[model samples]
Target: MGRRRSAVLTVLIALVAIYSLVPLAWLVVNATKTQEGLLSSFGLWFDDGRFALFDNVRQTLTYDDGVFVRWLGNTLLYVVAGAGGATLLATLGGYGLAKFDFPGKRAVFAVVIGAVAVPGTALAVPTFLMFSRMGLTNTPWSVIIPSLVSPFGLYLMWTFSQQAVPDEMLEAARIDGAGEFHTFFRVSAPLLGPGIVTVLLFTVVATWNNYFLPLIMLKDPQWYPLTIGLNSWNDQAQTVGGQAVFNLVITGSLLTILPLLAAFLLLQRYWQSGLAAGSVKE
Candidate 1:
């Protein structure tokens, strides 16, 4: 009975793996095919005599005067600026909330927790109007500024600080004549490394994948990030004259996913450390 149960479990796991990977496999296979092959061949199977992976890449870069590269640059900018700022704010705010006590601290924390519960999508219209009033709409700052205030990232950091950082160590640092800011920067920051990286990774992915904010804020196609750019390509591809763009859109999407995959592989160690740190006894 034990052997039979094990065999069934193994088969079920294998089936689940296949189910998850099949779409990704189809995307990879289709990305290598030319427009004609993409249209003519089975999506999951390779086409005969038509491997245009390089051609697709070249055309993807060359399309509409190489606008895709500009979009890539914009994406990198937004991700770095928004994620980096959000990570810093989350770390500082969370650390303060977790360690320090002051007037209205409970109220502040309550607001942070409430903010986390509020759906970001629900705030889009309000944010848009606020930016519009400031004459900041239709610019990169419109998308970036909103991305910087990640309530979930702040909540994650607060939870991490509570679990990962000890009050005793902070007290020791204070006793050793380290100013609060100095101690936080020199001591607690280093200790919070895993949490910081985890928060940064999460914020980066969130900003990178954000579509609706940019869609509502940005009016110029030149300011579009990969998400909006790929969407524009998709829209254009529906027309007869833009049929060839389908291959480029798919190829660009494949390219867009690589940076995120690389980031995960590189920072996965910190994520593991973060999970472990949260569980470690002081």
Candidate 2:
């Protein structure tokens, strides 16, 4: 009976893997085709004598006078600045909440929980109007500023800090003439390494994939990130007098995942450690 249960679990895992992998595999296969081939051929497998992966990539990069590269740069900028800011704020805010008791602490938590409960999309319209009134619309700040505030990240850091850092160590630091900031930076910060990396990765992915905020905020193509840019290419493919870039879109989509996949692979160890550390307090 145990053997049968084990076999059933193995089969379920395999099925889940296949289900998740199939679409990704299809994207890879289709990315090798041309615009004509993409529409004409079977999506799951590359058709005979229709390989155009290099050309598709070449066109995807060079299209619109290399606008894709600009989009990539913009994405990198947003991810770095926005994610970095969010991580810093979350870490500091979380550390404080975890270590210190202050007035309205419960109220502050109530607000944080409420922010987490609210979908960012639901607030996008109002946020856009507010930014516009503040003369920040169509600028990078319009996106970067909003991305810096991550309620979930703050909560994650607060919980992680509570477990990863000890009050005794903080007291010792105070006795050693270390200021609060010094103690946090020199001692508490090191212990929160995994948590920091975890928050960094989460914010990076969130900022990198942010679409709706940038979409509704900026009108200029120059400020567009990869998500909006590739989407524009897709829309162009569907419109009259627009460039036929369906294949470029597919190849671009494929390219987009590579950085994220690499990021996860490179940080997988830290991510797992962070998650484990968070789950098991002290």
Candidate 3:
């Protein structure tokens, strides 16, 4: 009975893996094809006799005065600022909530939980209006500011800190004449590594992939991130007399995802440990 159940579970897991990987497989295969070949060949198979991967990449980078490169830079900027800021804020906020006791703590928890329940799309319009009043619309700050608040990241850090950081350790640090900042930097911060990396990965992915907010906030093509820029390239195919650069778009997309993949591959160990940290308690 156990062997039969194990086989069934293995098959199910394999199916799920295949299902998730098919699109990525399709993207990889199609990225190698030329515009004509992409239209003519089977999507899952490589185009025969005309491998355009290098050419497509060159064109993607050099296209329209190297706008794609600019967009990539903009995306990196957003990720570094918005995502980095969000991770730092979430860590500090989470650590505080986990360790410190203060007035209205329950209220603060409720507010954070409520914020987490609110979808970002629901807040977009209101945020746009507020930014417009502040004359921050069409600027990078509009996107950066909004991306800094990660309620989910904060909550995850809070839970992780509760388990990962011990009150007794903090008391010991305090007893040793260590200041709050010194203790946090010297003792608790080291212990929070996995949680920090977890939050960083989440925030980086969020900021890097953010589209709707930047779409609504920014007007300048120079400030457009890869998401919106690639979207614009994709949209070009829809307009009358528009040049169809689908090959560049596909190549650009492949380029865009490489960083995220690298990030996951590099920090997945920390991310996994961070997720499992609070689940088991002694």
**Cα lDDT computed for each candidate against the true fold:** 0.90, 0.91, 0.92
Best by lDDT: 3
Clashes of 1: 0
For residues 1-282, write the lDDT of model 2, one tens digit per residue.
999999999999999999999989998999888777776778898966668999989998998899999999999999989999999999999999999999999999999999999998999999999999999999999999999999999999999999889899899999999999899889898789888888888999999899999999989999999999999988988888564778888899999989999988888887777667657664
Clashes of each: 0, 0, 0
Q: Please identify model 1 stretches exceeding 4 Å from their true place.
A: 1-16, 273-282
How does candidate 1 fare on TM-score? 0.92
Give me the displacement of residue 179 in model 1, in angstroms.
Answer: 1.1
The residue ranges of model 2 lying beyond 4 angstroms of the native Cα positions read 1-8, 241-243, 272-282
Once fitted onto the true fold, the runs of candidate 3 whose alpha carbons sit more than 4 angstroms away are: 240-243, 269-282
For candidate 3, the C-alpha RMSD (Å) to the true structure equals 2.4
Q: After superposition, how far is residue 96 of candidate 2 from its true place, in Å?
A: 0.5
Model 1: per-residue Cα lDDT at residue 146: 92
Query: Residue 31 CA error for candidate 2 (Å)?
Result: 1.2
Clashing pairs in 1: none
